[model samples]
Target chain A: MSDDKLERTERALDFSGIQAPEELLRMKRATPARIGIGHVGARYKTAAALRFGADHAAANDAAFSEVPEDIPARLGFFSVQTLCRDKAEMITRPDLGRYFDEEQKARILSSCRYAPDVQIYCGDGLCAPSIAANIPDLYPAIRDELVFRGISVGTPFFVRYCRVNTARVIGPLLNAEVVCVLIGERPGLLTSESMSAYIAYRPHPDMQENAYTVVSNISRFGTPPVEAAAYIASLIGEILEKKKSGLSLKQNEE
Target chain B: MKDVLMSAGIDIGTTTTQVIFSRLTIAEKGGFGAAPGYAVTRRDVFYRGRVHFTPLLPDDSIDKEEVARILSEEFESAGLRPDDMDTGAVIITGETLKRANAKEVAESIAALSGRFVVTTAGPHLESVLAGKGSGAAELSTRTGKLVANVDIGGGTSNLCFFDDGAVLDTACLDLGGRGIRIENHKIAQIFPGTKRILEAESIRLSVGDSADLPSVRERIENLADVMARLLAEALLLLPESPTLRKVVTNRLITCDRIPEIVTLSGGVADLLGNLPEDPFRYGDIGAFLGASIARNGAIRERLNRNTKETLRATVIGAGNESLTLSGGTVFYQEIAFPLRDLPVVTLPMDGANPEAYGEAIGRAWERIREDGETTAAFASEGLSAPTYEEICRLADAAAKAARQKDPSGSQTWVFVFATDMGKAFGQAFRRRMPPKTSILAMDSVRCGDEDRIDCGDPIGRGDVIPVVVKTLLFDNGERETI
Candidate 1:
C-alpha cells in the first residue's frame, strides 16, 4: 500500500479563492518540501493532515520493510548479508553492517569476477524501498555507459543490511581499481525513495572516510535515476583518468 | 576569470552618436560538484568617447562613411582597433532608424566595428536597455517594487515599466525635443508628428518662422504643454487622448499596477530641474519641453530626482549589459559559433503529457522544409523538476517528430529550454536519433516566435554558451537581418 502511494502522490495548491493558482503551482513544483498546503484555523486542514500522515506512514514502511528477493533475482544479482543478523540489530549496530562474516566473504570471492577496472553493486541501506524503485533504471544506465566507454566492469551483486563501507571490503577482495556502491539513503519526511552513489578509488580497510566521493539525493523528487546514472558514469571516468577520488582528487583539481 | 573580453557599444541616434568600450569578466557561478554554470561577473568601462552630432546626408539618411570614420578615430584614441572588440552591439535608435538607407548604413558600420557585435535593438529593445542603464531596473530589483523610466531623447520618448527588474510593459511616443528644430533664431525643420499637432491645435507654425517673435514663443510653449500633457496621461495610465493614441509606437502602455517610482534617461533628460535661460539654447525647443515635463501635474509625485544616468544610458546598456550566458550542462558535438538571426519556434509543455511536443516540432520542421533552411532552434518552457519518465516521453516525442519531418536525418537541430533538463533530454535523443543528425541542446535560454537568437563560441572551459537574444524587426516597415 505504501509503495503504491509513494508512486502516485500528487500535490497542488491547497488554497481556496486564489487569484493566481498557476504561480503557486509553479512554486510548489520547484521544491520537495511541503508547500501550498491548506491550513485550518490554527491547524492543518483535514486533507493535508491525512496526507502528511500517509507520507509518514510510507516513510516508516520504507525504513522497516525488506526488498523482495526477486528484485535482485530478476537482475541476476548474487546476494549476501553483512555481519548484522537482522533489521533490529542493523538499526542499532551500524558497525556490524559494514563488514561481512567469513562465509559471506568466501562466497563473494568465489562467485565474482576478478580484478576489473570498476566494480559496482547495490545495497539495502536504511531505505530499502529506494532500491526497489530506482535500481531497475539506474543500474542498467550505468552499465551501458561504462560498456560504451570501454571500461571493464565486474559482476554485479546485492548485499542485505549493508552500509557504505562494505564497498571498501569488496574492492580489495576483487582488486578493482574503482568501486561504486549504489545505496538507499535514510528516509526523510519529504521522500523515502531517495538514493545515493558512493565511489572510492582503490579503496581499502585503512582508507579514511574522506577517501569516498558521494553523490546523494537521487529520486524522482531529486536528480532522477537515469540522469544520476549518466552523471555518475562520467564521474567514474574522471576518477579513472585522475587515478583518485574524494579528498586527493579535490586537491589535485585545486 | 576565464573570459575577459573587450566589448564596444555604438549608438547612432537622431541627434548624437556615442561610443563606449567595456571589459566583461565571465566566471563560474554554480556550486561545487554540480553542473558548473557561468555568468558575466563584472563590467568595467575603459573608455567613453565624447558625443558627436550624427552626420546626416542632405536627404536625411545617416552617412555610413562618416559614422565609420568617427568610430575609427575613437578606436584609435582608445588605443584599440575596430577589430579588437570581442563582442558588443551597434544600436541605431530613434528617428534615425526610419531612413531608407538606415539598415545599409548600420550594417556598414557594424562590418567595420568588431569581431562579432551580435546584438541589435528595435524600439522595444531600446526601451529595455535604457531602463537598465538608467538604474530604474536595478532600483526595482533591489526594492522589489514597480519602477518606470522615460527616455526622452531628440526624436522619441521610449518608456519601460519595470516590475522587479523585468519589463512589465513598454511604450514609445512620437514626441521629443528635436520635433521642431531651431537654427539661428528661425524654425529650421518640423517633423510630421509636430506638423499634425500644430494643425490640430490651430497654431500657425511653419519652416523659416522667426524664433524671436513673442507670439511664436507663446505658440511653441503651448505645443510643449500639449506634449507634456500627453506624456502625463500615458504615465498615469489614464484613458489616452486622441493625440496620445496617435503618437504611441508599437504597443500601448500596459499597466496593471501603479509604479512606486519613475526615472528618466536619454539626452534631454538632464534638462529637467535645470531649465536653460535660452529656451532655444540647443537650437531646439528641448529646454521648454523639459521644463513642461518637469512641471507636469499627473506624474510629478512619482518622479525620482536622482536618476543614475541621463545621456549615455542606451549606449552603456548596449555595450556592458546585452550579453547572456547559457546554463552549464548542455550537450553538443562539434559545432560552429556566431549563428545569427535564426527565427524561433517554441514547444510549450502541457500538464503531465508531452504530446504537444510533436505538433510544435512538426510545425517548425514544416517551416524548415519550406524555407530550405538547414537549421532551426526549437525552444521550450520545460517542466520543472520533471521525472525521468516525463523527460523520456518528451525526448521520444521530440525525436519521433524529427524523424517524421526529415527522414534523411541530415539536418542540424537545436533545442533551447528554460529549465535544467538539457543533458537528460539530449542523451535520450542520442539514444533514439540517427547518427547523421547534428544536435545542440541547451538549457536556461529563452526565446519566442518574435525573437531571433545568436550563439557565440563556448567560453568558461566550454561549460558556457554565450547567447544574445535579439530582434530583427525594425520599427520602420521593413526587416533588418544581421
Candidate 2:
C-alpha cells in the first residue's frame, strides 16, 4: 500500500465501537463492563484494544508508584512504614509487608492512644493511586460519622508498603477495640484506583483470615468513597456493639 | 432471580370502561457486590375484562356503586383480589374526566383496588399512556423510527408521539366517536363542539334530527374530515385551521421531525377491524368515525394497520407501563418511606459553576414553591464520572442549598438523581448538613422538566423502590430540555 493510503487505513481503523439498540443502550449505560463492543474479525476493535492497553499501563503505574509525601500532612495524619524496605521488597516478600519495623512500632506506641474505641490506618498496598484519590473524602466522612455517634477515635495515621494483614499487627499494639485499615486493592485492567477496608475487632496475631470483615471496591466507578465511609462507620458501631467481626458479624446481621 | 408483581389497570372512558390485570417481573441484573440495580425485565397482561358501556347517573356523573360492582366481579373472575395487587393506576380518560364526580369515582376505585394503586386524569397524560399501551413506544425503540399513537375514543382523540421508547410530545382534540349521540337510528344530541363544527361546515344538524338522512351521514363524514385535517396539521407541523383550532386542547406538536408511523387506538379504533357491522353500535357515531378514518386518503396512506392494541391500550398501559423500579443503591430514611405526589423540579447542573449549584437549586425550588408545591423533590442529571473531590463539592453545594432553604433543618429534603451516585451524594449531604434534616435521596429515576413522581415503600429487601412518574408540566412555559 502507498504510505498515504496506509495512514488513511489506520485512521479509518479507529472504529467508534458498537451501535447498540435503545434497549441495550440502557443496559449498557447502567454498567461499566466492556460489552456490546463489536469486533474486527476475531480481535477487539482498534479503539477498544487501545483503551485496554491504556488501562493496563495505568494499573501497572499505580502498582509501582509511591504515595506522595505531602498526602499525610494534607490529611492531618502521621506516616509510618512497614517492615518491607522498598517497593521491590514490598512486591516480592508479602510476609514482610504485614509487620511494622521495630523503630516504627515504638513511634506508633508513643503517638496513638491505648485501647481506643476505633483506630483508623491508611495503607498504600498494591495501588497507591487509589489511596491518593479516595482518602481526602473517605477520612473526614468516617470521622464525622463516628464522632457524631459518640464513638471514641484514636489518632489516625498512614502506613507505607503495607498489606491488609497489617491491621492484625497494629490493632493489638494500640490495644484497639476495633481497627480499620483502608488499603489499596490490587490493580485490575479496568480500574487501578480502587480501595478496600479491612476491619477487625481485637485482632490477634494468630487470627484466622475470616476474622476480618472487608468492604471492597471503593473508587469513582465502584462504591464511592464517601458512601463507603458512612457504611464503614456504621459497621464499626455494629462491631463494637456485638464485639465481633467477619463471620460472626455476618451471622448476626442475618 | 426475578420477583413478580400483580398489577391492575382500570380505564374509565367517556363511552366504555374496562379493566386489565398484568404481571410485572423485576429482575436483579447486578453482579455480586457490583453496581447493584433492578429493572422491570418483563411485563405480561394475563387477564382482560370485557368492555362495558360506562354507567352514568342522571346528572352525567359516574355511577360509583355500579362501577365498583363491575370491578369486583372482574376481580373475582380473574381469581384475584385487591390485596393481590402490588402497584397499578386507575385512569379517568377523555370526556369522562369532565363528569361531575370523575375525581371522586377514580379515587374510590383506587381505594378499593390496592394499597399502591395511583389515580390520575388529564388529556396529555392520557395521550402518553395510550401511546405506550398501543405499543407505539416499543415500536419506536424497535424500528428506531418516530411513531405517533392517535387514540380516538368517544369524546376525544389523544395524540402522543414517541421516539426510542420515551414520550416526545402529546396533543389532544375534542374529536371522538360520540361527538354526536344517535338513539333509535336518530340523532339524540350533538355535543356543543360538534354542533359548532357542523354549523361552520354548513350542515344542518340538531338534537332530534333524523340520523337516516344523507346530510346526517355527511355530518358524520364532516366530523371525520375534521379529525383527519387536525391530525395532518399535528403530524405535518402545519398551521392549525382557524375553525379547528377551537377544539385543540393541551400542547401542540413541538417535535422537530414528523412521525414516520401512526397507530390508532381507543374505542373508535375497534371500528378499524370487524365490529359486528352495527351502525348504531353503542348508540354513538363511533362506527362512522372509524369508517371515515379508514377511508380518509390522507390518513390511510400513513396508518400502520398492525397495531398491538385497539380499545385496550389505555387500560394495558395504566396497568403495566406506569410503574418503574428505582435503582438498588439509594438512600432513604425509614420515616419517608412512602411519599406520594411530590412534584419534581429539575436543577440545571450542566456546565454550571460549582459555587452556583446551590443558587440554581434554590431558584428551582422557589419556582416550584410559587406553584404552591411546598414539599418537592429536587432532581438532577448528576456529574458524569465524578471523582471523590467532585462528589464532595456537589454534596457540599447541595447541603448549603438545603440549609439555606430550611434553616431550622426540621423538614425532609428529597432529591432524585438520574446518575448512579445517589447513595454517595446522599451520605455526604447528610454528614455536612444539619443533623435534623432528614434526607430521602434516590437514583436512576429519570424526570422530565414537567414531571412529578410518587415514591412507594422500598421493595426487594429494601434494595429498590417503586416509582410512578406523572408528566404534568406541559402547560408550564417553555424550558430547556435536560
Candidate 3:
C-alpha cells in the first residue's frame, strides 16, 4: 500500500476539539458510527466529507443493482423472481417484492420439497451485494449446523427483488416448519454490504410482525458472516424446540 | 446493579512492607440485549496498613516467618481473614526480589495472604503498577499527554511511561533511598552499587565515615544528578551514560516519544520538590538526595511534576488497580473457568498478508515450546467483524498450528480478544474444532506482548471474567529486560 493510504487507515478519527477524546475513541471502536470526525467550522472536514459521499454512493449502488446469476448457480440453487419487474418497480411497489409472480410461484412449488423441517432462501432485498458477499460463508455454516442437529432442510433457492416478508410467502408454499430468508439490508452510510437474516416459525399470510425474528448487520464490518451464521442456526434450534419465534420465543427464553 | 468484592494488596519492598484492603464494584454497562460489556464501576480502598521495615535474616535473605506474622497481625487488626478477600496480589518489589529467598518468601505470602492472591515481581510490572497507583495513568487519560512515572523505592528506581492509561515503556535503575545504611549518625555501610557513584565522583566515602561530613552530602547530590540525567536521556531515547550503564538494572525503554509530564512515587518521593531542612532525619542521605532532585534545573524545566502517592503507590496498585473486567459476549468451558499465569502470545494479524496466519501462529507456537510452556493464551487486537471466509481461514490456521504443538489435544486453547467479537469468533472456532477440544475465548482484555494473565471465574450470572494482567520475570533469562 502507498504510505499515504497506510497513514490514513492507521490514524484514528480526530476529535481534538472534544474535552475527552479517549471517550470518543472508545465509543467509535464499539460501533461503525460516523462520530468523532472533527468538523471544519460549519461542515465536515474535507476528508470526512469525501468518505461520507463515497459511502452514500455505494449504498445507492447496492440498492439498485441486480444479484449476479452465477452466485446461486454455483451453490446448486435455482432462482425465482418476485412480482416486481425491475429495480425501479421493486422500489415503487413494496407488495410486489413480498410475493412471487404466478409463473414464478409455480416453478418454486414444483422445484422445492414440501413439509420440510426447515426452509432456507436468499434474497436481494435492498442490497444485492450483501447476499453475494455473505451467503457463501453463511449458508454452508447454517446448513451444516442444522444438519448436524438432525434437522432436515428443504431445497434452498434465491428470490430476485426480494423483501423481508418473502419468507412468509414461501413458508406456507413449502409447508415447512421454519423459514429463514437471508436478505440484503437497507444500505446506510456506514456500510452498504450489511445483510440480515429474517426467520419465522410456521409463517403464514396472516402472521403478525411479532411472528418473525431478525438478526441484522451480517457483513465484514458488522457481525461477521460466519459467526452470524452460527448464531442464526442456534436461534433456529431454539425456535424448533419451543415452536415459536420473535417475541414469544424471546420471552420463553428469559 | 453492581457486584462488590473484597480485595487486598501486600507489597514487600527492599526497605518496607505494607498492606491495603479495598472494595471493587463490577457492573454491566451496555443496554439490555446488547453484547456483554462489564467494568469495575467503582474502586475504594477501605483500609491502609502501617509501613513496617522488611524483616530480614542474618544471611541477608527475607525473613519469611516474620513477614507472615506481620501480615497475620495486620489482617486481624483489620478484622478480616484470608478467606474474606475475593482476589488480590502480593507483589515483592524494588531490589527485594534479588534476595536469595525472595521467591520462597513471595510464594509463602501469596499462599497465606488470601484465597486467590497472586505473587508477582519484576521492574516492568512494578513500574506500571506504581504509575497506576501514583495517578499518572489517570492523569494521562484525563489530559491526553504522555506521563512518565519514576518510582524510587529503597533499592531500585523503576520508570514507566504511560499514554492514555496504557503502559508504553519501562526502565529500571539501581537508585533508591536505602542504598546507604547509617547508624548512630554515621555511615555504617554503603551498598556496592552506591559505592560506584562515590568512586565515579572521585570521592572516597567508606564504612565508619561520618554521615555529617561534607563529602557525604556531595556524594548524595551527585547521585541525584545521575538520576535526573538518566531520566533526561530516557525521555530523549538516548543510550545510557557510562555512569548510568553501571547502575542500570534493565535496558528496556521502548517508547520513542518524550513524556509531557513526570511524576515521582515510592519511598524517597516524599522528600522531593519540598525537602525538609533536617536532612539527617532518616540518618541517611535520602533527604539530601531528594533536595538535590528538587533543585535539579533540567528536570524542573522539561517536565511537569505531579504525584498522588509516595511510598504507597505499588501497594495501592497491587490491591486495587490490577483487576480488569472482560466483555460479556464470551465462550468458555466450565472446567477451565479460572486459569492463572498463562503467558500471552499475541499473534500478528495485520491482515496485510492473508497467507501469513499459519506461519505466524507456527512461529509463536515455536516460541512457546522453546520457553517450556505447555499452556498459553493467544491474543489479537483486530478480529472484529471479519468476513465469514476470513474467519474460517483464521480458525483453520489456528487449529492446524495448535494441533502441531500438541497432537494429543489434551491442552486447553484459550483465545483473548481486544475487540468485541469474542462470541462470534469463539462460535466459529468451535464449529471447526473437534468436540473434545477445550476452548475458552474472552474479549476486551487489553494486554501487551510481554504480559501474563490470570483469569478468575465469571462473576455471578454475567459472562464477564475478572482478569489480572501482569508482566513478571521469574527466571534469569526473562530478567534481561524489566
Candidate 4:
C-alpha cells in the first residue's frame, strides 16, 4: 500500500486583518506531557499531562463538534440514536446496544430521512469522551468532503460500545452503499479521549471480518481530528465507488 | 444361569472426577467352572478430583490416602471383592499422581486388591483417547491430512493436532472447568442450591473477591461464553477435515447442532439443573449410556476422527501395548482395530441423564474398559490445569499494564496463544467490553511468552506475557485515488 500524498493547495487567509499579536502565538504555545508508572517514576506525568491537554482540546474543540445544527443543513444528513435509553442502560444491556432501543427506535423511525447514497453515525462507544472531543471540527470536515463529492450522507446517529461491526447492525436499517461509524474506543490511562472510526462496505451483520476498516488513535496526540475526519470521508467515497473497506480491498485498487 | 456382573469405574481427573458403573454378562464358551459364581463383575474407572470430595492442594497428605481408602471401602460395600473375581481399574490423576512415591502408592493398591488395578493417565492421555475415539483417528488413517481436538475439562484443556494418526503437535493448558468455577463466582452465587451442598459438605469454595450474588451469576455466564468460543477454535483447527471434532466429558457437542445430552459425573456436572432444552436436548449422558451400547458410537465418532488411525478411544487403547493393565481384562479383537482416514463431522454437545447416577457412571466405565486401556487418551505437551479466574487475572493484569503504556491503543496487540485460552479469556473480557470487540488469537498458539519470542519484531520488548496485541496499519492511497 503506497502512502502517496494527495493534492493540496492551501491559500492562507488574511487573518492579519482580524488582529491578534504574533507575539501572543509564541507566548503560550501548547506542550504535550508524558507519564510513566511502576519503576518509571513521575517524570513522565508532565509529558502525559501535556499530551492530555492537547488531546482534550482536539476532542472538545469546535473542530470536533457533532452538534445537531451542523448536519442536513450543510451536508444533507440527519442523526439518530441507537434506540437505547441511555449510556448506562446501553452498558448494562449490550443487546439493546446491538439494536435500537424502544424510544430510540421510535425516534429514528420518525426523525431519520430516507434513502441516501451512504449513512454515517457517531457513537459514544467505549470512549464517549473521546468522540465528544473530536466531533466538533471533524464532523464538519467530513461532511464538507462528502458534499463536495456530491455524495448524500443519509441520517447518521450515535452508538455506545458501538463496535466497528455495529455498522453492520445498522446497514439493513438504512439502505446505503456504505456506513461509517465514528465511535469511542475503550479508554486508556494515558488519555481517555481517543476515538476510532469503523467503516464497512455493506454494513450487514453477516459481513466478513475483512469487510471493515478502522481509523484509530484519532485524538490530538495521535491523528489530528480534522485529518481523521477527512480521511474517513475519503474512505466513504472509496467504499461507495469501489465498494470495499478492509483487507480484501486492495490498498491502491481505487 | 442368567448371572449379571455389575462394576463401576472412577476416573479422577485434574479438573473433575467421574464414577461410572455398569452390569454386563459375559457369554460363557464351552463349560464354565463354578458357573462364574453368579455374576462376574468387571468395574471400569475414569475419575477426576472434585472440590467437595478431593483435596485441592497438590500434595498428597491425609486427603489422598483417605480418597483411595474411601474408594476401596465404597467398592467393598457395593458387593465387590478380590475373591469375587473379575477386572477393575482406577486412574490416579493430576496432582494425586504427582505425590512423592505416587507410582509406588498405585502399585501397592493394585497388588492388594488382586482384582483391582491402578494406573495413571497424564494430560496427554485425553488426546490419545480422542485420536482413537474421535476425528483424530480419521485424520491418521488418511494420507496428507491434518486434524485437531480441543478438549475442555474442569481444570485443564487440550489442543492436539495430528497428521494422519501421528501427533503433529499438542498443547495443554491449565484452563478448564475449575477455572470457570473460580473465575465465575456467579455460578456458585446464583445456584445457592449448589452452594448449600458445598457448605453441607464443608467445602470452602474460594471465589476470590467476587462474593456478591450478581457477580457470581455473571461469572457462570462468562464460563459458558468461554466454552463456546474455545469450542469454535478447536473445530476450526480441523478445517476441511470432516472428521476432526471437540470432545467434552460425557457426550459429543459439535458446533453445527445444539447440545443434546450430558452425563453429570464430575463436581460441576452434578450441580447442573434445568439446563435449556433447545441446547441440551439429549439430556444427561449418564442416563443415556446406561440404556444401551448404541450411544457409544456417537461420541466415539466424535473422538476418533482426529486420530492417526480411526481407532476406538479409551484408556483401554493403552491395552494395545499388551501389558496387563491395572483395570479389567479385555479379549483380543475387541479393541484391536485399525485407524481410518476421513474427517468426522460433529454433532453439538448433549447433556441429559434420566437414569440413576450409579448406573450412568457404570455404563461410561463399561465403554471405556471394553475398548481396553480403561482410560481416555489425550496429548501431553503443554497440559496443566489452572482455574479460569487465574487465567483472567493474568490476562487482565497484563492488558491493563500494556494499555497504560500505550494509551493510543497502538504499538501492541493481544494475541490469544491457545484457541482454548483465547475462548476462555475472551468470554470473560467480552462481558466487560463492547459487544463487537473480539479477542484475537494466534493461528497455532501456546501458553507463555515463547510465542512472543517467536514473533520477535511483530511484538517488541514491552510485549507482555500471554498477549501480543499488534499495531501495524497498512495505509494505501485508494480513497482519494478512487
| Model 4 interface DockQ | 0.00
TM-score of predicted chain A against the true chain A, for each candidate: 0.89, 0.88, 0.88, 0.65
Model 1, B1-482: lDDT tens digits are 34797888889887889999999998776343344578788888889998999999998888888988898899999999877877888888888878777778777876774355644477788888888878899888766668989888888888889976888988788888888999999999998777777777677889998989999988898998888887776776445677776777666677767777888888778888546778788888888888887887666778887788788888888887778888766766556666666667787776367777877888878876697666678988876556556767887888898888767677677888887666667766766678757777888898876577877777765656878787656456455554
True contacts kept of 3: 0.25
C-alpha positional error of residue A251 in candidate 4 after TM-score superposition, expressed in Å: 84
Task: Write down the worst ten-residue block by lDDT for model 1 chain B.
Answer: B28-37
- Name the best candidate (by lDDT): 1
Just chain B of model 4: what TM-score? 0.36
User: lDDT per residue, candidate 2, A179-247, as tens digits?
Assistant: 999999999876788898899899989998887888888886667676677667877888999899987
Better of 3 and 4 by DockQ: 3
Docking class of 1: incorrect
* Clashing pairs for predicted structure model 1, backbone only: none
User: Please, what are the lDDT tens digits per residue for candidate 4 over residues B1-482?
Assistant: 22333333444554333333344343332131110112123323332212234444444332556556655665565556544433344454443444555555456556654434345544454444434334444443343344555444444444455543555544444334444233232322212222332344343444353534545434334334333333433344222221112222222323342111211112222223333432212221211112111123332234332122121223233212101111011101112111111111111111122122223323433453464422221101111222333434543543453344334433322332221133233333323333333223221232221001112111111111111111111122111000
TM of each candidate vs. truth = 0.84, 0.81, 0.80, 0.27
Best by TM-score: 1
For model 3, residues A182-250, the per-residue Cα lDDT tens digits are 999899866778788888999998999888888887776655676677668877888999899988876
Candidate 3's displacement at residue A164, Å, is 4.6
Residue lDDT tens for model 2, B1-482: 32888888889898889999999988877453344468888889999999988899988889999999999999999998888887878888777877878767877786774455555557788898899999989998877778889998888889999887888888888878898899988888887667766766666778887777877767766776666666667766345676676677666777777888888998887786333456776788787677777776667777897889989999998988889887776776634666777777788664246667778777877787787777788888876445556667777787788788888777778888887667667777777877757778888789876676778767765658899887653365432111
Ranking by DockQ: 3, 2, 1, 4
Report the C-alpha lDDT of model 1 over A116-175, residue by residue, as the tens digit: 999999998989999878887777777766776789989999999999999879999989
